[model samples]
Target: MNPAREENPTLLDGFRDGYSVHLDKFDGPLDLLLHLIRKNEVDICDIPIADITRQYLDYIKLMKVLNLDVAGDFLLMASTLLHIKSRMLLPPDDEEESEEEEGDPRAELVRRLLEYQQYKEAGMVIGARALLGREVFTRACPDPALSAARTEEGPLEVSLFELVDAFRALLARIPKESFHDVAPGDSLNIADCINEILSLLQDRDTLQFDELIKDELTSERVIVTFLALLELCRLKLIRIFQNGEYGAIWFIPAVAPEQAGSAGEAVQSPV
Candidate 1:
């Protein structure tokens, strides 16, 4: 009742929750009711109408006293709870009516609560899915010319993973040991592999991926070839394709003379 408190009213004027509360904080009537039910630790299906109704009205009174903007939805729910409580207090007109046949006054309210809870959970699930979608993103291919050319020619039917899987299958057939004398620290350089692949691709418009490496069965050579293919694809120098799923992959050369010339120039420069 303090005059100063009335001048600057708040929903938490007399409430003790260690923080301020406001009418806008609640989503709607059902949301507020659910909060009260949880606070009292009462079952939603078997709501204590008398106690809840009292608490509901107390908050309404507080809102009025504080001059807070109380939505019509809050008043509506208050009336509904009061009506259900009054019906429970009254006796049935016919004592002959069996308990099974008699409808419970709380049935409608329970149904609404259950329905709201279900939708609330569904909304959360949908929101979570949207959040996950935000975490994943696909970017357009960096080279516009290559992308345009590929589209004009035909879409690359095989994904990068599918091509890698095919290469892996081929690699498994090769023996671990090399045919010639073993060198302790010999390894194929990616640059050399790339140059070799480009040279072969220049001679032909398309080549079967397996045939490119068929002459070399060593694991090192196969891995280097696979890496070279990936590099070429990244550079837009070549594209891998297949007619169908699990089909033989073809390495189709991308017609990029300017880009290829630049790459060759860079590699040829004295390091």
Candidate 2:
């Protein structure tokens, strides 16, 4: 069989360009803003533009610092937020103030968010209904032999933003290190890092995200390894899970039988 790199040349190109973290599947900038709004427990219609903008920019900055690929849409949202913020700072005329909610700087954004939220929730309901059978039918009694493999329930699903938040917290607790480019070496390339992670996963069911990069003190190395973890997620060869809302995050090898069957075989990772 062809190596993963052969199957995913664009992913390899991403590596050469120093961007290996794929964020597209995690939703877009608007979704992120919604997440932030919900996180802060603030009213969506009355978003604190300045505070949310700062937090959003901070996330973007962290992604850059970690070498995670940031799409242009995120930057565009940042600018939009700034524009709204600037407009709000200006004193309003009686005519403008008398205007309906439409006159509010956040009016349009609030409308979009409310609409998008409804659509998202409706979509989730449909998706859950559609997959209900898969959830129920797939839970048939397991073989006595494979019973030891407790992954039948599968790993706890995690989101990209959660991973980012976890990484940010991880960085805060660690000692400061001078960030630099991670030179590709005999033992430090992403492909090797991927294999290292797979090897570690093989010994146990799950690994703490901290355990993967604890030895790699440099920011670049940690970033690259984290990207490797993201790559594994992209490939569906592993799963990232958090214990609870603010619990420890961990990684587990593929939960599917087909993927687990290949645990004994070499994985073809992007070179």
Give the least accurate 10-residue stretch of model 1, judged by summed lDDT. Answer: 130-139
Candidate 2: C-alpha RMSD to true structure equals: 22.6
| Tens-digit lDDT string for candidate 1 (1-271) | 7664554343335453345555445678887788778888999989999888877776777677668788999999999998999888888546544635356788898889888888887888987773322554336644443444355465556787788799889878887556463744756777777777777766777788888778868877888788878877777777788744466798876766456646744542321
Question: Each candidate's TM vs. the true structure?
Answer: 0.41, 0.39
Q: Under the 3 Å rule for N, CA and C atoms, how many clashes does model 1 have?
A: 0
Identify the leading candidate in terms of TM-score. Answer: 1
lDDT of 2 by residue, 1-271 (tens): 4364444343343544576655434477888888889978999988999888877886676567667789998999999999999989887767866765457889898888899889888889888773433443345533332333335575446789989888777667666544444555655667778877777776788899888888766666677787888878887888888765566788877765455546424445344
For model 1, what is the error of residue 55's alpha carbon versus the real structure, in angstroms, after optimal superposition? 1.6
Model 2, CA-based lDDT = 0.73
* Clashing pairs in model 1, backbone N/Cα/C closer than 3 A: none
Taken over the whole model, the C-alpha lDDT of each candidate is 0.72, 0.73
TM for candidate 1 is: 0.41
